[model samples]
Target chain A: MHISSTEVDYIALGASSDFRADGRHAFEFRDVIVESHLVPSVSGSSRAQVGGTDVLVYVKAELGPAQGKNGTEGVITFTAHYSSVTGLDNEVRTSNMLNAELEESLNRLFSEKQAANLERLCLLEGRVAWTLLVDVTVLKADGNVLDVASFAVRNALLSTLVPHVEVIRGEEGEADEIEVDDEPASRRLLLEGDPPVFISVCLLGSKWMLDASQDEEASMTSKLSVGVNSSGKVCGIVKAGEGALEWDGLGDTLKTAANMGVKIIEGLRKVQASRAETVGFFA
Target chain B: MGLREFDYGPLVSVERGTEVTTRERKRQWNELRPLFMRTRMVSHAAGSSYLEAENSKVICSVNGPLANTGGRTEAIERAKISCYISRTKFCGLEDDELEKRATTEYEGIVCRALESIVRVEQYPKSTIEVHVLVIEDDGSTLSAAITCACLALADAKIELRELMACCSVVNANGQLLLDPTLDEEKEASGSVLVSYLATSGKVSTVFQTGQLAYDEMAQAVELTISGAREIAVLVRNCLRQRESKDRGL
Candidate 1:
C-alpha cells in the first residue's frame, strides 16, 4: 500500500497528537458489524465487516476415521484466503505469499492448547470423530484482517451446532456404527471451551493504535496481534507486517490486548445475547 | 454375496444441499444462478471485483502493466499474463491441498482465456497479473473465476480487445445441466467449461471432463455460448453502473 507524502504527513501528525486519519483515538477500533449464518450451506458461518475490511468465516464439520493409530481427539482446521482484493493481487507470487501468511497467523491463533475443544467432537474413543474446518475469506481487505477474521470465527463457532451421533454396537460383539440425528433440533452443541479472540496493535513511534485501518497499517512500523481468552490469558501472539518494536513496550501493549480482548469478548457476548432472546442468525 | 444396499429415488435436486435460494420456480437448465457483482473494491489494485453466483463466491483483483522483474519474461511482443489462485480450506493450517494440481491447472486456463484479449504489445516489457480467490466453492467455480477476471480487468482499465464470459455445462442422465453445482458435477457423466470472448463471439477456452457424443458436445457448446452471452450482458451493465456512479448519476 503506497502512501502519498500528504497522507504520510497526516498520519505522522495524527500519531504525534495520538489521533488517527479517520479521526479515531490511539487505542480505538473502527465500527465492527458481525452477522452470523451468512453461508447457510455450511454448519455455521459469519461475516464481519470491520470498517472497509470484510471477512467471512465459515465452519464445516465432517466425519473422519481415527488417525492417532489407536484414535485420539478430533481436530480443528483453519484457513485464511487473502483474496485478490488487495493491491498486491496483481503480483501472483505476492498474492500467494500473503495468503500463506494469513493462514499461518490464523493457525497460530487456533493451534493453542485450548483454542478448540476437539474431544467433544469425538463420537468414539478411537474410531470415529469430527473434523471441524474453519474457513476465513477476505472479501474486502482494508487492513487489520487477521484480528477481524478471528472475531468472526469466534462468533461463527458460538452459534455452530454439531450433529448428534448415536453409537451402536455391531451384531454379536462387533464394531460400533454411528448414526447421525436427522433433525436439526436433535443436533448437539459444539465448542464447550473458551473461544480465543485476537486483537492487533500497531506501533508507530511512541504511539500505538488498536485495530489500525489500512492507511494506518501501512504507516505503522510494526504490528502485533495477541489472542486472549476469557481468563485474560494470552493464548497466542502473531507479529504481522514488517516493523521495529521494543520488547518492553509491546509487552505492555499485550496487557492492553488482554484487558481489551475481554471487553471485546463481552461486547460480542452482549450482541449474541440480544440476538439470542430474539431472532437467530438464519432468521 | 457380500452386502446389499437400497437406493432411494432422486427426488430432491442437489443444489439444496449446497447454497440454494428458494424461489417460486427453479431456474431453467440454461438459466444462471443468482449473480451479484461489484467492482472497484480494492484501493491498491488496478482493478478488482467481487462476484457471488449462488454459493460460488469469488474475488478477483488485477494489477499491472507494471515492470516485469521476473527473468521469465521472454516475450517481447505481447505483455505477459500471470494467474494465481488461492483456495482456502474449510479448516486447519493447510489450505485445499488436494486441489493443488487442479488450482494450477485452472490458473493456466484463466491466463489463456485473458492473455489474448489483453493488448500486451501496447505495454512494452511489462507483466499483467490476475489473482483470484474462491471463498466458497458450491459449483461452476472456473466459470465464476473467468467472468470475475474479465470484470477486474475492465475495472483496472486494462486495454482489452474484447470481454470474456464463461459457463459450465454438465450432461447428466442424458440431460444438459447448466451451471451445475458441485454435487451435480460429481454426479455428471460429462462436464464442459467454455469461455467465450463476447465481443468477438469466439470460444477462448474449453475444458471438458467425462465424455459426450459429438452431437451432444455441439449442442452443449451452443447452449454454453448462450449462457456466456447472458452473463456478458450482466458484466457489461456492472461496468456501466460503475461509470455512471463515478459521474454522479
Candidate 2:
C-alpha cells in the first residue's frame, strides 16, 4: 500500500480516538503465540508469532575461556538474519539496514549491565564462562517484529538448559579438568532475574500503541522500545523511526511502557507454565 | 543453531580409475551439480535472484543505476560497479575471520565477471550495487556467487552486452572433476573457475590456481565453459518465466 497523504491523515485521526484499523485499543497488544523447544539440536529454541510477524529464536551456550581484564564476565552475542520471506517490501538494502539496527538494538538490550546479568553466566569466575549465542531469524514480516523477536529470545533463553560442568584441579600440582554432567536436566537456568521483556510503543498522532501491526506501522513516526524486568525496573530504552518525542510526551510514554511490560512478562510466564505440562506443537 | 557439520562422504581417491559417482543422481563423471535458479525473490532490491547448487546456495540482490557515489566523482563515463559478498555466520563452517576473507575473495570475483557484461556505459556516474550472501558453502562458492549475481542483474532488467553464468572445475590428481563437492575440492590438486557470456560465448572471467600441466589447464577451462553453457540455459529460463509471470500479474 502506497501510503498517500490522506491515508496518513486518516491514521492519525484514528489514533486520536484510541482506535486502530484492526479495532485494537491504543495500548492493547497483539496476541503472541509461542512454541518453545522447536529446534531440538540447539540448547533452547522457540518460534514466536505476533500478528503476521514470525521469528525463530535459537540460543546456544559455549564454554568460554576467560580473556582480558574482564575475565570473570561472561558474554552474549546477538546475530539477526532476515530471510527473503520477509514479504514484498523488504529489499536487500532495506533488509540490511533493518538488520543492522536490529543487531545493535538487540546487542544493547542484552549485552549491557542494565540488561542481562552476565556474571551469573560465568562459570569459573576469571577462568571460564558460558557465552550465550542468540540467533534470531525473521521467518515473516509485520511491524513490531523487533519487539516480538526480543520476546522469543527471552523465552528461548529461559528454557535453555546447560550441562552442569565440574572443574577439578589447578591445585596440588595438577592441571584443571572441566567435565560436563551426563544428566540432561542438570543446570536449569533461572532466567527470572533481570532478563527483561521488551515492549515497543508506536507513536502515531495523539496515541502511542503497543505492538503495532504492519498497517499500524506505516504512518507511525516514532517507535520507542522499552525493556523492563519483572521487578518493575527499566533496563533499556531505544527510540527509532523518523519520529521524535517531546519532553512531556516522553515521560508519559515511559509510564505506559513500564505498565505494559509487566503485563507482557506475566503473560509470558503463564505460557511457560502451560508448556511444562505438555509437549508443544513441535517437540 | 548448534555446531553444524555436513557429511562429504569419502574423498575421491586418485586410484579410483579417474571416475567417481556423486552423491546425487547417477550421472557421468563430467556431469554438473544440480542447479535451481529463481529471480525477483527480494521485494526491496531492483532485481534479485537465488541460486542453489548441491549444498551451496547464494542469494544476489542488485540495487542500482542509482546516482553518483557518496562524494569524489571520478570522471568515468561508465556506471561505477561495486560488489559486497557476505558469508553469513550461521552456516557454521569456518570462524569469523576466515569467513570474512572468503566473502571478500568472492566479492572480487563477482565484481570482475559482472563488470565485463553489464552495460555500464549507459548509466554514467551512476552505481549498480550487487550484494551476495552465501547461505551455505559446500564447494565452488565463488562460482556460485558470480552466477547468482549475474542472474540478479538480468532479473533487474539491466541492459547487458551479454547474459552471463559461471561454472567451477577441479583437477583432483590426474582426474578432472566438474562441480566438485567440498570433499572433492579439498582433495583436489588445483581448481579452475570460468564465467561465460551467452551471446558471445566468450569467456568473461577465468580464475585458475595451483600446479597443473598445460593440457590439464586447457581441458579444465574447456569443461568449465561447457558447464557454464548448461547453467546459462537455466538462467535464461528463470528470467523468461519471471517476465511472463510479471506480465500475467
Candidate 3:
C-alpha cells in the first residue's frame, strides 16, 4: 500500500514518542506463533505466523551427487515462493527487491553460516549425499517477512528427519549400490546446533524499531536484517533501503539487534519445549 | 564429467604421507592487494572504468540518466538504477547456473549500495544503468565490482553524495584476513564486506555471511572501514590522474 505523506508524518511523529499503531513500544515484536511437522509426507514442515505475516516452510531430502569441493558434505538449498495473494506485484520494484533480499539472506543462513553440520547427511564420501531442499512460501506479508520466513525455515529444519542409507561396494569398474532403510524408527535428525533466526531493525525517524508492519515499513528510512543463532553469535547481516547509516549508529544497531536476537531465540526454545501437540493451521 | 574440465584446479597439494592442506598468505593481514584503476576504458559508454585488484579484474560501464520512455511513472521522485553483473568464461570455475545466480545477487547488492550514495533525486524521470563484467575473479569479486561501478559513475560525472570505497575481510577460524585470495576465501569461516563513504562517515552497505561472534563481526566491520578509507585515497588519486590526463598533462 502506498501510504500518503501525512500517514508517513504521523507514523514518524508517533515513533519519536515510542508509540506505534499496534500499541507496541519501540524494539517490541509481535508474538510469533509456530507449528512444526505439519506435513507428514515431507521430511519436515513448519508454519509460522508473526503479526499478520504468515509463512510456510517444507524441507525434503533427496539423494544426489556431491557438489563442488565439499564432496564429503551434503548441500542444503533454499528457495522462496511468494504467493500471488501476498500482494507482491512484479511492477512494484521494491517488493521484488524485498523478495530477492530475503532469498539471499536465507541462502547465507544455511550455506555460508554453516547453521547445520551437513557432514552427517553424507552417506558415501564424494559419491552420494542427501540434498535438502527447503522451500518457503509466503502466505501473507504484512511486513518483516524475512524474519518470519527464517523462523519457519529454522523450525522446519529442526524437525527434518533423514533415513539411514547403507552403501555397498559394487563389482569392479561399477558404481556403488546403496540401500535406504525406510523404517520409521531408522530416521533421525542429523544436524547439530540450532539454525539462526533473522531479526530486522528499521530506522523509523530517530528510533530503531523491531517488526515494522507494512505501513510502518513504508515510512522507515532504512532497515538492517541481522541473523543471529541461539548461541549468541552473529550469523549474517544484510542492510536494505535507501538511507545511509552513521558510523556510530551501526555499532549501536548491531548491539541492540544481537541482544534482541538472543532473547527471541531463548523465548522460541522455551515455547517449543513447552509445546504439547502439532495443533496445525486448523487449530 | 564435462563440467569438471572447467575446474580451476586445487590451490593446495595433499601430501602423500598426510592429509593436511596448508596455504600461506602472501601479504600481511592488514595489507590490501595492489590496485590498478583506469577510467574511460570504453569509448562508447557514458563512463567506463577497468579496475584490477591484484588478479581480480573487473570492467564497469555506466550508460544512462536517459529519459524514461516506457513504463508508467512510478518513482518520479528519484531516478531508478538497474545493475547487471556478468563473468567471462575464463574468469573462474564454470557452472553456468551458479555463475548466473551469483551475478544476479551481486547485481542487487551493487545496485542497492550505489542507490544510497548516488544523487538520484536530481535526475527525476530517468534511469541509470550499470553493467559490470568480471575478467578475473581471484576473490573479493563483489567488492571489486562495487568499486569499479562507483568509479564508472564518477567518470560519467554523475552527481553523488560522496565517493564510496568497498573492502572485504574474511575470518578464518579466529583470524581476520583482509583482501583474501580465492584459496583463503574458500577456507574462511566467515566473511564481511563493507562499503563506506569516508567523508560523510556513513556506511552505504554492510553484507556478511558465515558466523562469528558479535564482537568479531564488529571488529571485521571496523577493519573493512579502515581498509576502505585507504582504498578511497587510492580511488581519489586515480580520479586525479584521469583529470590530469584529460587536461593533456
Best of the candidates, TM-score: 3
Residues A1-283, candidate 2: write the lDDT tens digits.
2466688888888998887888888888878898898987888888889999999999998888753246777788888877777873544425354676676567666665435666777667578888889999998878888888988987887777778788876787876778889676555653544467778888788688888887678787667676666655555545554332342335566677777877888888887777654343643
Q: DockQ of each model against the real complex?
A: 0.01, 0.01, 0.53
Q: Per-prediction TM-score, please?
A: 0.52, 0.52, 0.89
Give the least accurate 10-residue stretch of model 1 chain A, judged by summed lDDT. A241-250
Please provide, for model 3 over A80-192, each residue's C-alpha lDDT reduced to its tens digit, 9 standing for 90 to 100: 86887786544653455555666777988877536777776677778888898999999988999999998888778877777867789989998888998987676776554
How would you encode candidate 2's per-residue C-alpha lDDT over B123-190 as one tens digit per residue? 88898999888888788778888888888898788988777888888877678888887777777756
lDDT of 2: 0.72
For model 3, the docking class works out as medium
Which pairs in model 3 have colliding backbones? none
lDDT for residue A154 in candidate 1, whole number 0-100:
86
Error of 2 at A2 (Å): 4.4
Candidate 2: TM-score, chain B only: 0.86
* First chain TM-score, candidate 1: 0.89
Give the alpha-carbon lDDT of every model: 0.72, 0.72, 0.81
In candidate 3, which residue ranges exceed 4 Å CA deviation? A67-70, A93-97, A164-178, A190-192, A274-283, B1-26, B96-101
Error of 2 at A3 (Å): 2.8
